[model samples]
Structure formats: structure tokens, C-alpha cells
Target: MIEQGYNFGYLDENTKRMIRRALLKAVALPGYQVPFGSREMPLPYGWGTGGIQLTASVIGPDDTLKVIDQGADDTTNAVSIRRFFHRVTGVATTERTAEATIIQTRHRVPEATLGEHQILVYQVPMPEPLFRLEPRVAETRRMHALADYGLMHVKLYEDIARHGAVTTSYNYPVMVNQRYLMSPSPIPAFDNPKLDRMPALQLFGAGREKRLYAVPPYTPVRSLDFEDHPFVPVRADAACVICGSRASYLDELIVDDGGTRHFVCSDTDYCASRPPLQEDAA
Candidate 1:
């Protein structure tokens, strides 16, 4: 029996059906945004309502859900979402990346390699890649319909012309399946390559805008770049002080008043899973 004051999966049957239909269409046309009836979630629009809605639609009793914000599971927003799901649907919640069946993320992808069994749902504030160039919704729709991405190319080229290289660091636009241009959320460029031919199914939901999109497992995702200047993922040269991982994304923390700072893995789960630093080293 479902819990009181909440429908199964925290969403009503009718809303779930509508979202499921939209998801099916999104998966069928990979990288294409499918508009749906975005119901007003309890959470605010910019506070991961899209991801929560998507999760509510797809989650099952058998599914293990994980929620993360800026790569940390213990953050207030992440914890609230996880607890909300547990309260509503009574589904198991996990912090481990590999153990999760579905993960709702805000800014960063997990440091661990996701497998085919996992589904990643990203909370997207903006899904239209060409919106900045042309604000008109109708004009942007027409541009996408015609596969006209010249404005994006020109913008990148101008960045190269001014700065020796493309300066776009986050929310790097990607060409999915060699057709549609998709935004991979606000994840840094370092995580951009991870989206290419990844084993996990990726879904993007924009609640305020009432749109959702998908990238099927093993689909090709190439970052937009000029022929002469290729796309390069940038990261700090320093290693994480806590986990000693150089590859994982690092967060700078000021430790002392003397301006002593340390870089640590932004992924709490990733850092916790690593071997502890030696006492002698500490």
C-alpha cells in the first residue's frame, strides 16, 4: 500500500503517466527536448524541482535513489531531496555512486565511472543552447529545426580570436549523436568528456521551462570546438589534499588565517571511499 498524503513515487498516477510519455519521446529522439506538463512541485523552480519531478516519475520501490548537489551528498539541498523521497516513497537512498539505480544531480557528475545500469537525471536551468544568442523562443526553435548553429560557432570563434583559446569553462555545449546540440548542465568542462559514449543513460529536466531531454547509453557526445583549436578539459594541477586524487574535481578551502589553503575532492563520496591519509604524513 502507498503511504498517506502521497501517491506512488511521490507523483500522481496521471502526472507520472504524462512524464513517462514525455520521457519515452525524449529517449526516442535522443538530445531533443520534449515539453511536458510540469506540475508545481513543493520545491522552488530553481532548487532542483525538475530533477525531483523526473525522479518522482521514474522511481520504483526497487530503485535506489541518490541525490547530490555540487558533487556532495550531505549538502542541505541534496539531503533534503533524499529525505523527501524516503519520506514519500520509502525507497532506499544511497551515497555510493555504483550502488545507485537513479541519481539526481545539480552541477557535477560523479567522479566514479557510471555503468549501464544507472540513470543520471540532471536538473537543468536552461536547456536551449541557442537562447543566449537569440532570446526569441520562436526564432530559437526555428534555428534548431534548421540545424543552424552558426551563432554558437561564431561565439566560440570570437572567444578564440580574443583569447588564444575558447574560454568557455562550464556548461560546454555538445553535439549528441552528431545531430542535436545539447547542454550537459552546468558541469565543468572537465566532466564534458564523461558524457561521450557513457554507459549510463543521461536525462536533463528543466522544470521552469517545462522541458526534458535524454542521451541514450553509448551515444556520441562531442564538445563544440573549432578545427584548429580543439576542446580541452581544464582542471587544477594540484592534487586533493585529503584523498590525494589528482583527477577528481577539487574544491579550494582556506584552512587558516594565514591564507593557507588546501584543495580537496569536491565529491564527498569519492573522497570518503579512498584510503585514509597516513598519520605520519598528516
Candidate 2:
């Protein structure tokens, strides 16, 4: 049942309208962070507050919501967000990626491909890609205005010099529409390819940072790399033990104190939908 005494989707109608206006500006300028009046949510920072606010803003009574953390629907963060939306909006919730009209995600994207009808909302801890390299916010904004990405290229080159490859496995930087450098949230580099020319719309909200950005459908998103050292998506070589999926990203788990390890699909819905491996194949 929908929670009483709270507006639909939890936040008031005016706040939702305000967020949607910010979202419009974000979609217009892909990868450009637009400031929004970030509201205080029931949850604390670093706990998907931005994503929750975004989801609440866009969701309608007809929308089907899905929440995933590190691509798993059953994780504590995912489950809590899903339940929270269900309670407040009373909208239908599902674990299936294809079924959801909007998917609020943390850390990882789903293994299944998204459609044009779907929208993906990301919880971002830090919206600025140059935050680590440049601590001053004003200078970073100036750099972005000038389209001066020399520092980012230099950082990647330094990584190659020290590690022989780009060591940034998550929060990988990308060039959006050949114009702006964007941070694709904290998703593994393995999922970076999915962001390139994605049919579905992508939205990012950084609640603590009070920033919002977007990538409209079919927008160009290229991972930053050099010709000699092309961008490569890396993942575990082992197949999923449950579903025998060789392509899906796997999470390594320690089975015993002896340090024995096994690999399973990080995407629970994708794993569950596939036929399990035969006893002999296992």
C-alpha cells in the first residue's frame, strides 16, 4: 500500500517539477553538470540519495521501477531502494531489467541491453571527473569551459608509464559527443562499452554535490585512450558457476578459510534467467 501523508513518489510536486526542469537542461547539454537545489532525503549521503531523488522525480504511477547495486538486485542497497519506492509511490517494481521503465543503479549496469523506452538513473558520489586531479572546483569549471582536457590525457599517460595500462578500472572517463569529458559513475570499465551510443537515455544525479547531468539516447560516448593503448574492457576469465555465462561480469567469492575461490554472475537477474549448467558441465 502507498504510504499515507506523503506525496506521490515521496517528494512534493513542486520539487519534482524543479528536478524535471534541471533534467531538461542536462539532456540538452550532454555531460555538462547543471546545478540543482538538492533536497534532503530520508536517507543519508553516499546511500543513493541522489538517485532516489531522481527516480522519485521522473517516476509516474505507470512506471515500473528497478534498483540494483553492483548489478545484483538482492543486495541490501538495491532491496532497500526498491522497497522504498514501492512503499511511497506504489508503483510496480521488478527485478527484470527489460521490464523496468526506470532503473536506478549503483556501481554496475545490468548485463541485459536496455531499450529506447527505458531510462537509467545513476547515483554519483562525485560528479566532477577532475575532482581527484584538481581540488579547486572553480578551476575545474574553467577547464571544462575551455575544453582543456590535457590534464586528463596526461593522467592517463602517467598511468600507462607506471602500470603499463590505464589503471582506472571504475569511474572511467569518457568523451561525450566529442565535446565534454564525463564520468560514467563508478561502473566497472567492463560496462563502459554499454554507455557508447546506448539507445536508452541516461541520467546522473550527485545529491551531495548538487549536480545533475545526462546522456540522451544514441549519444556518442567514447572512452579516453591512446591509439597504441586502446581501451580494453577487463573482467574475470572464469565463467559463472551458476549459469555458465562467459560474457557476463563475475564476482569472485571465497568459499572457505582455505582461500578457495569461485566466480558467479554479478547480475543476479541475468544469471537466474539463464538455464543452469548441467551436473557434468559444472
Q: Considering every candidate listed, which one attains the maximal lDDT?
A: 2
Which lDDT tens digits does candidate 1 get at residues 1-282? 346877877778999999999999999988898999998988889998888889999898999999999999999999999999988999999999989999999989999999989999999999998888899989988887888898999999999999989898999999999889888989999999999999999999999999999999999999999778999998888888887898899888899999998999989999999997887866
Clashing pairs in 1: none
Q: How far is candidate 2 from the true structure (C-alpha RMSD, Å)?
A: 0.7
Candidate 2 on 1-282: residue-level lDDT in tens? 999999999999999999999999999999999999999998899999899999999999999999999999998999999999999999999999999999999989899999999999999999999999999999999999999999999999999999999999999999999999999999999999999899999999999999999999999999999999999999999999999999999999999999999999999999999999999998
- TM, every model: 0.97, 0.99
Q: Each candidate: how many clashes? A: 0, 0
Worst 10 residues of 1 by lDDT: 1-10
Q: Give Cα-based local distance difference scores for all models.
A: 0.91, 0.95
